[model samples]
Target: MSEQPKPLPLVISPPRRREKPPRHLADLTLEERQERAAELGLPAFRAKQVSAHYFERLTDDAEQMTDLPAGQRVEIVQGFLPGLMTSLRTMQADRGTTVKTLWKLFDGALVESVLMRYTDRATICISSQAGCAMACPFCATGQGGLQRNMSTAEIVHQVVVGARAMARGEVAGGPGRLSNVVFMGMGEPLANYKAVIGAVRRLTDPAPHGLGLSARHVTVSTVGLVPRIKQLADEGIPVTLALSLHAPDDELRNELVPINTHFSVAETVDAAKEYFDKTGRRVSIEYAMMRDINDQAWRADLLADVLNERGRGWVHVNLIPLNPTPGSKWTASDPADEREFVRRLEAKGISTTVRDTRGDEIDAACGQLAATES
Candidate 1:
């Protein structure tokens, strides 16, 4: 028909290439970075130099790295140190002693870290994943669902950035050192096993390889990933293991920590005991007190009984007041209920303390602010 408008040859265009995700220095291990530099025709030692710049100096700028050859600095920085996190917003409270920053990763994934300064120490709470896979109903982060596991570098970069900020006197009360690192920010630390462990090494390793912080000052928290917990125990690094055990009995724990469905309370507790036996570092039992939910006096007694049965030493209970996320029905227990809960645990000869609540004003609770934005 009309030369059939002989169908023009179909010309298919190649699909547009997807942009590579932004690379943070924290994403690579020392060996991997050395290999990458080799691929770029740079000397093996250049990787160590770059690491020193990023980890010790806390600067990715090639110009600032006087130690590296001027010609090689640009390529090293471009090839190995692409920006990984962008600060979105920061809020401070508690007389500026507590500062929380919301960061957007290269892929638009968001996580947060809080830097709290005390007279004696400074602690940075870091996230192991972009969001949480553990659907703890009361937690804001758990509700957002998991986006992806953070790379080792991504996890370590959070601490490096915080450390840099502290060194520069950016946070309140002038210059300070990052004394502690806690995996209590967002996501389950054990879920992303390899990367989390790699980050731990990078954090505790000596300068040129890591920030060189002591392993003892680091704490890794999990919602009781039984097998992984045991695996961690075998790693030989004695970082504190924090078990988020909200409920003492199986019935409530099963609902509160869905993973309990996979590993029963007894099994989880046994795993923690194994960890204690291996590392000799007392495990921290993290209990978030929610009104009428798991705060009943009887439940507290049951919790103490379980801990006592496990043995008197090598475990401590850190009672946290539920930081109610926006629009959530869960609320913190009344003062009397909280006091009684602690009293019961102590009566059982268990050491307990109410966790100091910080960052309340700035969605300081792990996933609250990020959830709202997402």
Candidate 2:
């Protein structure tokens, strides 16, 4: 008999690092920042001042920090706010309400983030890593494979940048606050667990210490990293967990999201339920509907059954219409099929909603622009 092909090794952690990104104030806790300032022979209050400028005032320029002595301003800013990532290119759609930016990290690794402004709230979807390790076949980020994991500050900077844009009225809307953050950009957030958690803390901590966003307003996505999901439940942070369970059955999910081979659909769902039980935060089931693949009416029934069997009211099904990559075989599901799929789930008493698709013209699918640049 012909031998079955060897399975590829899963990248649960990033490969060895080449060089680490420089430290920034956002990466440090308040105490650590104060200690660093003392080591630099500056007053500890300088640390809080710099934090205010970055997190509160949304300015990194030393010149804008008039409170500090002119001689010390440059040193203080350089010590805390070394440049991290720069916008390589930016594209906008939805009348400039949806802006997508491709960022070049210090080492030239590329990532992308999307800022979406709506009537009630402004949201920024930030990347946790330059590329992804979860080789989910349908996702642009997963197609490119993994680069080095990003530092805590690198992830937080994306939000600060987006928040700055909103605060300055750079987006189509009038000046507003960035109220939401989703770790659904270019990487598997859980795979970079430590940095992702640090970023979450930095974002939700009170002003001068961090961005002060409510933990409820943050969502972190993972492709069934079961252990990480469990660890997150015990972290005391109530950020919503989004499990990208693209298929209901193991046989299909193993192919769609490669991580399923390590953690089965049953195991993944169980972890998600435990998360909801512990945190009282409803887990979001993210399923991208691909035409004729995982989008059939029967699969919808199976999905509802899978979720319902876990117990009700602990999950919400978010149906995303697949954003097909250029020349990719997968395309968005037919409207009729999508409607039927939703009908089946709703009929089964599963709370379901179709996602508002945005940023198609600007390659808003996480890693598409970075992939294109490469």
Q: Which lDDT tens digits does candidate 2 get at residues 167-201?
A: 99999978999999999998889989999999999
lDDT at residue 118 of model 1 (Cα atoms): 92
How many clashes does each candidate structure show, in the order listed? 3, 0
Residue 368 accuracy (lDDT) in model 2: 87
Please list the residue runs of candidate 2 whose C-alpha ends up more than 4 Å from where it truly belongs after superposition. Answer: 1-11
lDDT of each candidate versus the true structure: 0.86, 0.92
lDDT of 1 at 160: 90
Off by over 4 Å in 1: 1-25
Candidate 2 Cα RMSD (Å): 1.9
Q: Which candidate number has the best lDDT? A: 2
Among all windows of 10 consecutive residues in model 2, the one with the lowest summed lDDT is 1-10
N/CA/C clash count, model 1 = 3
Which pairs clash in the backbone of model 2? Answer: none
Q: Give lDDT for model 1.
A: 0.86
